[model samples]
Target: MSEPFDPARWRPAAFLPERDVRDPALIFAIAVLCFLACLTALGVIAGDRAAHGWSGQLKGEATVIVRARGGETPDAAAARAAETLAGVPGVSEARALEKEKAYDLIRPWLGDVTDLEDLPVPRLVAVSLDRKRPATATVLQEALKAQGVDAVVDDHQIWIKDIRRAAGVVRLSGASIFLLIALAAAAVVAFATRAGLAARRDVVQVLHLAGAEDNQIANLFELRFARVAAISGALGAIAAALTGALLRLIGGGAGITPALPIAWLDLLAVLPCPLLAAIVAVVAARLTARRLIQDL
Candidate 1:
């Protein structure tokens, strides 16, 4: 097993500060900003997918639309097709569509169920295939033809493919956005660390003149910067979470489906982000200090 990282004992005081445990406010800020952005993006992507994918579960029930072709009666054709499908292998249940039920399906767009009487609503059969090795279109097609019903199969795979592609795009976009956010976070840390170092330059100069090692001076800055980063990161994360929750509540509706819940796991999963920000600040500080010392 890989050993855990011990920041204190891992390097000299120049790289690892003794007083680093104070607070990491700035680091926390950057991390929380990134985490919130990531979570929001994820939620948006998830909600879109869930709504599109699970809207109507057609997989569990196969629909056979018997066209009113030739001199064949639509009702008769549907009944014959339903009987054939029910007898087919791997078919658990089959039923011919009742006129009231068929009209109700079109009632959404056509207004009243009575309005669909003139519409050529073809004979319909609802079939439930056994879970194991469900019947295929080829088998069902042949059986329907034998029963004198012109039937077509719609498995909804084409639309599902399009949705999957959209999901891929969403995930890719989210990744890219988060990457940019992280870069921004690193830049912020670098800037803050430089500012901190500049403010303490006189103290550092005095320490150096007093025969204190470069490592000792570096340690003080690292500790201070790390603390600032940590605290800031935590605050940012909390704020992000609260904002997300509020938005979720605002958008909550029976008709609306969210991608995923903004749970503790996502929040907790990125808790180490603040530490990473602090590390960036510390490194930036170290590099600036080295440059300053060299120029002297």
Candidate 2:
């Protein structure tokens, strides 16, 4: 036989049940948003790295188009320009590309041309610059002028500026996307809190009349939903990190694409997601619960 219940030993049932039937749906939706946010953060980091890499490569080199003059052969003019550019203080090395290299550059436009030597094709010179103190276009051009070699220098200044602008755009776009996802997650939690309060109106009324303070009622939902969001965040963050790792493994050291190389370190960007999710949930749940509870 069961013992009789004593008033002193009786404990009240929780205002909200330990688990709700609708929580799984809420968790799934929030988790998907968190996953997308993490991926966006990782992509932003990788894209920034790629843009910097391309810019650095362009900055450290220049090109020259050599035009023959005053009875000089194309090859002789190119070699003279290369030697002149090599003597510049900031230039590391300068070499004239072979005729075949020039043919490959123009073959697409000119179609098949077996007797390419007859046409007055200008020669090209590739210049390597010193990393610590690279040569500028004006300096290079002056050096060629001093040697009486007619050539044009392309220092890639225009290309580098464009790449930097692209990187800034990528960063701005990523931040906007992340903010949108966070707002979406907060909205979901707020709606869920409101629905939960509406469904348990009678219980909330009884608790309020029984001397439970407004903050106490709000705190209960705050802690409960915060825990749920924290767990969901972990799930989503783990999934995103795993996807990034797979790309890193598949691409090996080079990464999935040259433009966006996923690094193992980039996966760490998702680490703070759980805490952020909890904070958003706490604010959302507390505000929603208090507003609806006060009306009752």
Candidate 3:
């Protein structure tokens, strides 16, 4: 007597008892892949934030270095340059740094020497420009020259350009890493699906002979892989979140900006990694089963 089909009594994974042993390795691989993908996504977010921060801080700002010569002190030269810059059309404000502060800036490279004051350190003038009517380095230099102040203008554009280029490289590298991890995850799921199919070949052949559809057989593999992937991916995502949090805490303690900025919008990008991993596993399993089951 043929029993009626009852969805509640059907469990596809029951076809092979050995799946219990093999599934752990597959799950672990998926978890590692998910961890790497999440980390790369976080890296992309951090690079974007850092690039924006650098651009915001450096745009429309410049530095003036006043050289001391002909019996003029660095402070006097800096003061004259600041006074000249104050009247410039595009310049908003200028301030001369004190000698002690200047010495502190170079203390990192040159150790504390008692004759530090004797060193001819050029005075530094920080200049702010109105973005609406930005001042050019050439114009600032001409203004300083007209006032007989020997100074060099650094508009910081070069540094900003270098920072932007570096950010681009980081973003590209992160994307490449993400792609490789995703490919590796798909390969792992495919291999596991094929192994499971082989282990249950006899059952699959009987089901095929008994008039089961190809998709029906494929579903058996997909469901198993998808469930495993979801659990493993979630574990990996949690680990990544904890790691990011720890790094942020360390960065805060060290008085440095964290690579991963904690923002709701940025975190939203990371939240989908586990779900995407599950989807990848499901699709890989389905495709692998469909192709391999045809010979059965």
Candidate 4:
């Protein structure tokens, strides 16, 4: 009588007895890929946060520069411009900036200046616009002109656009890198599968002669590679996560805040890298096995 199937003995690994089925090179390649994938995901998350934060902080805000002209002092013109801006319908607040602060703003370009008083530095007025009733740069400039203050208003919209475009480029580059890594990983897994199949060709021929189906043989290799990929990928992902946490801690110790804020929920992006690696391995191995088996 035929023996009944035993659930305990039905593990997929049992079908593949060759030690070469688990390729160390494949595992190492998969681990490296997973590590890079984790980093890419983190970069995308950070870039997105930084872009949104910059936009939120700079939108609807402007700086008004009052130049001294026609016997008018810069400081007096700045004060008048601030008063005029405050009375504008969409302007929430306008404050005249101190000369010392204005000097500091230009210090990076001009270096330390002991005689900043002699420099023809324009006086600055910081303007805040109400979100519900946003003011246009043209209106603010016209209002200052009406008050006899020769001024230029910079809304910083162009700078914000450039920042967002830079973030988008960063995100696109990271995604491209991630995609290349994934494709390379799949290629590695396929190569390893073929190598294993070559090593066990005799066993495969014997099994076929003994009535084993092609899918049965393919399953053996798939399961073996899937397990190795899962283990190696998990190790790499864990290492990457620990490294990221360590960096955050070190940055905090150095009193450097990250440009992009990290929250607990960001872990979701990092946690799936290993699983994606394993799925790639399994699919590649299965496809390679089936194709090779068909040729046999």
Candidate 5:
């Protein structure tokens, strides 16, 4: 049976050992960082979507506060203004809100009104802007003035600006955190590579004596650590995907809370984590190995 052994099937052994005792701990640490990074990416996606949604809704609308002039009732004046605005170009729909809605709007500041009927509360006209050609605040004002309606228009420019600013802040914070996590993971891998090189110094010296180049030696460590990081990244990515799936199911498509909505498609972002982790590890390990070897 042994006589049939083929020379063609022979394979050379790796310069580095197949596995190290410290592998489990290193994998665990790197995996944790990958998991956090994946989660951060998902948060950023959800937050950005939420911000765009709120801004889009506000962009397509305008509010008009109408004050009754002369002896006309507030409702009659508001109705007249609505009619006037409805006929204006770029105005999709214009209608006067009920008196109760106006009272509700004021209740936050004035609390419950005892003389609600006596108070001349300004009526609200909600104007839907045309998607293709929206009306400007100046245009709306001019139209209202020409019709002799005393009104003030709020185009939600202030609210939209604030939302966009907050969204930018969120995106910046998430990116910073994700960057820090990646660096920490790289640092851990670099440290492990240095430790490995130190422990294997005798083997490195023997290989050097046998005519191995510094880059050749460094490549061994790079391949070893890259494999470890890839495995860790896969584990972390799978865990993150499962957690995201659970959240999406619980919250439905819109997310659990209105603030953070997780969509199923967002989970796809983790798909590249393994390759990214491997690349980071390869760079970190190569640099650390070469530096240590040179110092030796």
Candidate 6:
């Protein structure tokens, strides 16, 4: 009987360390916070896509209006101008607007646009461009001027500028929200680390006096914290998914619409957020343990 082979001297204490972060309540709280942060991030991503979709779908097409030169019978000049534009190299298809359709467009602003039809609307040609469209506004304008009608190209680029500006603002706002969430997570981790250190103060002191190395003590804290955070993160991500699904169901039932919907794809994209939160918590715990262990 070789002294009964006591293994306590060589092996570290199993689950007897100061921080045994296997608590269910703490884990649940951490998970919930992570899920909320991810939800906000998903909203930001969806907003960005909607802005780009609106801008891209409407860009590159322009409207051309051929106005009569005011003195002569306007029909011949308008037709000649239309014929000239249709033959231009960049112009793919040019169609003169029917009077009814033109009147309908002005109805919103002028009210009873049928009365305004007699007021010269200038023969409007909606121009479609081919792949290798010429830099044709100036060329077309000059050509139309030669044809005795004043022509103007309305390229619709002003809306593009506005859309880009709006998108930039949305991106900046999303960045701000992400930063705030990170700060909140850091704060939570800091608070949790401090509480954990306080709880295990006596255990840490006993271990320090027992000749256990500082690294070993720190390792115990890191392990406990990491395990707790991983469990919490997983729970939080799952809860978040459930909540998002519920909301989507409710919205669908009501036939509600948003510029962007909360889809499973976005939810999947954000699934890693909780895991990142856990990593942040573990790092915070490690740093806290190192400092406190040194003080002891």
> How high is each candidate's TM-score?
0.66, 0.87, 0.75, 0.78, 0.89, 0.76
Output the worst ten-in-a-row residue range by lDDT, candidate 6.
253-262
lDDT tens readout by residue for model 6, 1-296 = 56676666676557445445446666666766776666667667666766666666445456776667757434555566668778877777667766566567767878864476467766567766564544356766776777767778776678779988988888788768967875786567557766776688887888888998878877777777777777777776777677767766776832114555566666685677656766776687778877777887
Global lDDT scores for all candidate models: 0.67, 0.86, 0.77, 0.76, 0.86, 0.68
Off by over 4 Å in 1: 1-63, 68-73, 79-120, 125-149, 209-214, 248-270
Q: Write the per-residue lDDT of candidate 3 for residues 198-239, one digit (tens) a residue.
A: 777777787778988888877877787778888778877777
The TM-score obtained by model 3 is 0.75
Candidate 1: tens digits of C-alpha lDDT, residues 92-132: 88899896777777678777644565677876788887766
Higher-scoring candidate on lDDT, 1 or 6: 6
Better of 2 and 3 by TM-score: 2
Better of 2 and 3 by lDDT: 2
Clashes of 4: 0
Q: How far is 41's C-alpha from truth in model 1 (Å)? A: 5.4
Residue-level error in angstroms, candidate 4, position 123: 1.2
Off by over 4 Å in 5: 1-11, 109-111
Collision count of model 3: 0
Q: Between 2 and 6, whose lDDT is larger? A: 2
Residues 110-172 of candidate 4 have per-residue lDDT tens digits of 998688888889989999998777798999988888877888999998997987887788778
Which residue pairs come into collision in candidate 2?
Answer: none
The residue pairs in collision within model 4 are none
